[model samples]
Target: MAFEMFPTVNKCESIGREKHTVVADMDGTLLIGRSSFPYFALIAFEAGGVLRLFFYVLASPMAALLYYFISESAGIQVLIFAAMAGMKLSSIESVARAVLPKFYAGDLHPETWRVFSSCGRRCVLTANPRVMVEPFLKEFLGADMILGTEIGSYKGRATGLVCKDGVLVGKKKADALKKAFGEEPPEIGLGDRQTDAPFMALCKEGYIVAQNPEVKAVTSEKLPKPIIFHDGRLVQKPTPLMALLIILWIPIGFPLACLRIAAGSLLPMSMVYHAFWALGVRVKVKGTPPPPVRSNSSGVLFICSHRTLLDPIFLSTALRRPIPAVTYSVSRLSEIISPIKTVRLSRDRATDASMIKKLLQQGDLAICPEGTTCREPFLLRFSALFAELTDELVPVAMVNRMSMFHGTTARGWKGMDPFYFFMNPSPAYEVTFLNKLPKELTCGSGNRSSHDVANYIQRVIAATLSYECTSFTRKDKYRALAGNDGTVVEKKHAHLKANKLMGC
Candidate 1:
């Protein structure tokens, strides 16, 4: 059926991927001192419920028994439910309000801090009631809301009855999030117990921090991702591994494995290329809309402006549809470090012609016609690839807000390493799609030359992108406006001045 459902529309579309919360367990989690069992139970007891004090009273023995027979399960989870079952709603709220904070102090997981800083909002989901956990969260973590099992009460006295049918666990926690926040839940979820496994599943993305082997096993096979904890504050990126693999493979197998991987345009090799610049690289997009798959209707040969040592990657990531790219033969060294599929254009006429024919047949080709990256408003001469291809020429103009030194055009930029040009931490690139040229403009009769076609395409692209498009002689058709006083005075103002002087 190909049907898919998510907590929210934003989640369904990936717009809210970065704005979700991590729903985590407290106690053995974010805290390291005395367990919060006594406090949690006291609150539940006051709320008029059966106190399951066996976990608190006999925690060591019980944990030992489980470790020997079954597994070292989440010790905090057992005690929490016991506390809830034993309390009256009113009494538990009072104890929770008073004692939750004292136990919250400790070194929190570094992954949690990253989520807090990066995501839109962060939240805590625990079996403890809001009155007990709310104050600590607000004072320390500044959580948006708490989703926990609620106990009912009346007047000022104890109800002596568990109001909710069941404690929030597994499927119930997912229900709780949906009930509180509606169907569109947060992007991240975090928890410490097997009970929270279902709730974490409801979130679009987040991590599950398994404190012990038992909890890890409980959720291990069930969760979509492999459980990982924060080693420190920043997650260690896998770039170094990729770099090492490529460097090591060069000697072991020589160039054969690298050549095959590159020629096949395998996705894994593409990922390796990305890892090369992982330090400087960051994901960027205009929006997450699927790229246009139709034939190139808006054509001028897409002469994209190049910048950042990873311009090819930027094009691949930013443009919705895949683009054919033209590259210099010397730049092929990148195949060893990162596999990029490109049309190899040679300065030789026969070789260039064959490559151009292949690119035109492929439909969308990203031609860096300028041959090299340059400063804004200045562009270099168009390469002959433009002259050879007879298609709608669309100028794909790029204005680089930042420079990456690890690119093909950068000084000292050998093709061995990956350097990225990010607009910022979040890539905000400007990709202006210039208007396409009409076919008749270049197809006029017998004597039309490739240079003539190249010049015309060049001027249109220059005028469209507002770059100073010049020719081999360095004199553009627009040179008169480019501070050339002799040309401007002689070509433009001479007729006006002569008529005025003669009083005609």
Candidate 2:
């Protein structure tokens, strides 16, 4: 039986293959992150408003149950597509036209797009309905053929029915390719899911693209992603319930946070650390600190990576001592709620560098050179300002782990307090204090500029985590997210009235 032919992946040093039929999967294979349906659904929720947002997320599992008991995996996929019901084709298409380019710019599987572009007879074969995936493929990749579920619609909206053909999944997908091509199986196939194996057999060879090395290993060596870290945060499109929760909790969380900081003034630093545990923080530490320098250790500069506003608080708690922190771009009042001293950055680099030196000479100081919380895995280029201040640089790696409710954010209201972050059921933190960078990295005596020292220290941290070290600075990230080419400062022009125009 055809079921006997499972797909196998073969790894090659390069994807220089030419003139082969490229049949690719849409979700995990071609796109870097989540599948197309969920991503489209997110855009729907954003534009459709709050009630629709809740319905989008909750209705899926319920519909999946209804479909699964009646049919199978195919039914589950149809339910996922059904979430797009009640939208005019024109409306959805307009949203797709805007969001698709931004998504493509920000995320991609390393080799899939380029090879698919160059290959002959490019086809997108997926269980996601052809209508839903069509506009993007037709517009961007010049898709010659697309084989997917057929959606029956009434008036303008999706009918949530798998018209005559049903969901084209697994073996059925291979059958669809045969029926369309009317020849030998395609010359090459690309996919990420195990379900894609049968269709892959239609090709002379295949490449499996996914984050899980073991999954990729079953068919091929894990493919190298183009960017080590792409923008990782989901758009914070809160459903009505989440919005209500935030509104109700703000009244409560905002006040209690103030009291917590006030009480922190009197509490011993040890008491403060455990109190955070009461709010569900589990911290793990690695490496040794240079023998307990008294709370008054001089010229000890801590170079930390940034993830959340709560970073310095977590650090002081982990070290069991207060370390005043310096930052840039935080809201004006963020420091009022902090239990530790926060020196906001000044515009002049020379003056700021002088101020940092004075602070270090008095006691330990911590600074996040990235100047922003990176939701992605990779580290942003560290600022050389700290490297310019002094050479006693100790690199601190900070990661905030949260499954359902993230403690870290790059977007949220200005006044949201740290205690509100602790409201997450349990948030684990990992901290690594690597040995102070060697004298070569210090280079404070002017053998090298601060930029070189900053780059080396960032590499040490990136190496520890097997992360891709990039020179992409915070400004580069903001530009990519906003879809602005470098040098265009997107300030509001006086005539600007409608919000979020032209996707920039």
Model 2: lDDT to the true structure: 0.62
Which regions in candidate 2 have their CA more than 4 angstroms from the true location?
A: 1-17, 23-53, 65-121, 125-224, 230-268, 290-298, 375-377, 410-423, 437-441, 483-504
Query: Could you give me the TM-score of model 1 versus the true structure?
Result: 0.34
Give one digit per residue, the lDDT tens place, for model 2 in 61-128: 65556544755455555454545667665555444443443354344455566567667678899877
User: Best TM-score goes to which candidate?
Assistant: 2
RMSD versus native structure for model 1: 24.0
Q: What is the lDDT of candidate 1?
A: 0.45
Query: For each candidate, C-alpha RMSD in Å?
Result: 24.0, 10.3
- Minimum summed lDDT over a 10-residue window in model 2 is located at 494-503
